[model samples]
Target: MEETAGDHQACRERPAASHLSWAGDGPETRSGLALGHHRPGETPMSHHLRTLAVVGSACAISATLLSSAASAAPGSPGPARVDAAGDATALKRPAWTRLRAEHSKKCVEIPGWSKRQGVRADQWSCVKQANMQWALWLVQAPGAGGVRHHIYAIQNRNSGLCLTVDAKRNGSSVTQRQCRNKKYGDNYTKQLFWYTPDNRFFSQYAKGKCLDIAGASKRNRALTTVWKCSYAKNQRFKNIK
Candidate 1:
């Protein structure tokens, strides 16, 4: 049977809730230190000086606390402050790589290294070709341990277009299109994907859907498509070389 993007629509029930949009837990708002009220005998100049003195004292205290926190020995007790961007940065996939299907050993590529949009990506014999290399760029950052994993935009090295799905359901057209933002709202997540935490090689572009090879065929030029997210061999892929 010929393979197309819109092939396997309902492999399993899609989760009732999924975190498609993502963002970090940004820095907390802090209030400035308050100086005491005016004294009965205080002149304007004296009050100014007193205010400066209070500020200086507060700065010194802050400095001391900072020094202590910085110098705290290994295995210290207090909870270390967590940066909101840390989790997003940890999942960064900046390096370009050639994704090879686990079952066929062929790399995903844009046919003929075409630079046109709407070109369906396919699998070909692994090679040092420009179209085969892809980069997973973090498009949306997930909150610290938040639900919906971080989203990445997969771009073809040669065409520079992003991998986008025609629809959210399985077997929708998986083609290279101009990178679009999620805010644009016309089925925006068609281009957004995230690596499965349980399986390092599985990439899901939509809820319950993942990138897959048609019939796991070893033949060159085998079309790639989206299928229900699973542990299936055809759905698994890894970096070439």
Candidate 2:
């Protein structure tokens, strides 16, 4: 299909409810650590001093942990604590968890999956199929290869009345050839699913394409289609916890 934004028109669904518009505060107020507006007499020096204090405290804690870990043997509790730091960082971001919650809350459950054999299909009562249930995750293949080598398109198989099962897509992009089955088969509908947790923050997976913000609002009616992977930040969807 033609590449345009808003290609998700066919699947009926609400707008604001699915999308969170978080710009993460502008550059001037990016940190969001300040109290109310500053008083006229307060010197800029104070802010610098406070910032340095916070940084120093964090460094000191890190240094202490590192020093302890250095003294410990290879298989020691100290190493475990150091390792936890990495996991903790990932846990701090509730992206995927939020997405799952939203899917359960906003997505309408469609039943009738068994009839289509390997395929699945479902409709959401609250959110549009496109917004809630009709999307896929694009992941990087593990190994040394170009961007296309690691990119994959994964989506649930929809057949008959049931929606979603186990089916995945592996390729640089969408395939033009359609699969036909004498008994029952479906041509990829080319619908992308935007799994969002908190609204603005979302992780999207396309059957053969990636979501592009610049084109989203413009061509709203265009059907979903595959496009070159630009790896745009908008395409980087976060899964909400």
Candidate 3:
């Protein structure tokens, strides 16, 4: 016999005695607590212990997060970052200033020429000495002849003396000639020369000043003038200091 519609509705609204049990037959309802929701088999005491464990774990995680945040907070000095900046600053310092200071006092010493006057050749040494001025020479050469030969003059402003290179008639001596600017055949060329504190000679005898030599002279007796650099045999000034 089929149950009447009114009877089914009444049964749904008013569940049977078995349905009144705390643990129903279905797995979700069978456990005193919701079955799959958490640990279904745990007793009331076990549930409390599990809750306590979760709370402790959450507290530990929160503490770690807070510590990390504090370490990164504003005004907190990060040691590695500070070290990196210091290293960078050290690297940025100019190296040449120290080099100049270190070698400033050392005078170049050479043979033959007098330290009192005339050009002398010498090597750079690390020592503070008055004679150091002679060790340094100003080099000059003309433009076109930079390849063939160099012209240079050694001058000591403090000593108020200058030296030049001149080829003697016999090549017998590397004469320390008086420094002067002499005119050549044209306005474009002139005499050019330089000297070393160690009595070394560097020079250019080409036909014109560095500027005028561009297209002027063809060969011998061309005028030459002093310039900053010349690759000529004469222009190479040995850096003693």
Candidate 4:
């Protein structure tokens, strides 16, 4: 479902976010209003928490609303939704983002800020730290063979390495490695990935396999691995907040 010009009125009954400088009609006027939504099965981020500590920028929040006013796309519910942390524009730019696994509600982090290859990925309590953020870089090889889905190199803000999967099989370990592609420079299939409408991250190493939380455990420090895509909560992740 997408939102258009009328979405601004969809939440007329709900009060606007606190400290909003203005309550008017356009982004040009810096008056654009935006709303956020939680995916099915996920807890709705509380507005109270957002007001207490906003995580995104004013430009991002406003631009998102105005952008949606002119366009619509799947997974794009309205202008742009700001979760408890901030505006939902994780992949809109080649920016570093925080990915939270749905089932555990934890942010993916490179344990201990290790900068070496083959370090397995882990999910931990969400925190405002560099290790928790990942920078997404699009792999541009339009007609490359073995390519079936849009791919992006998921790089960690702290480790400066791309997320890499060991093999194209279920139970394969997903680790971090230096981004290098002999044919396409940081476009190596094993280091590339794509997300589906179901919110699962599939590595180019195998479209059938998704980034999964080991054992579906909600405990902090649960390791992440590649598993057959099941659309299960453990495999679902969102780059919001």
lDDT values for all models: 0.63, 0.29, 0.32, 0.68
Candidate 1 clash figure, as a count? 5
Score every model by TM-score. Answer: 0.56, 0.22, 0.25, 0.57
TM-score-wise, the better of 3 and 4 is 4
Number of colliding residue pairs in each model: 5, 35, 28, 0
Cα error, candidate 4, residue 125 (Å): 0.6
Q: Per-residue lDDT tens digits of candidate 2, residues 1-241? A: 2322232231123222211222452233545543233335766666556555544554456555556656664542121121212223222222112112122232222233232233222222343332233222233333534432322222222311111212233222221121211122222223223333223211123343443223322222212222334444433434322
Superposed on all Cα atoms, the candidates' RMSDs to the truth, in angstroms, are: 20.3, 26.2, 27.6, 21.6
Question: lDDT at 119 for candidate 2?
Answer: 29
| Regions of model 1 farther than 4 Å from truth | 1-93, 144-148, 197-205
* Positional deviation of residue 146's Cα in model 2 after best superposition, in angstroms: 9.5
Model 4 poorest 10 in a row by lDDT: 77-86
User: Model 4 segments beyond 4 Å from truth?
Assistant: 1-93, 141-148, 182-187
Candidate 2 lDDT score at position 60: 58
Candidate 3, after superposition: displacement of residue 237 in Å?
5.3
Candidate 2 ranges with C-alpha deviation above 4 Å:
1-141, 144-153, 160-214, 218-222, 231-234
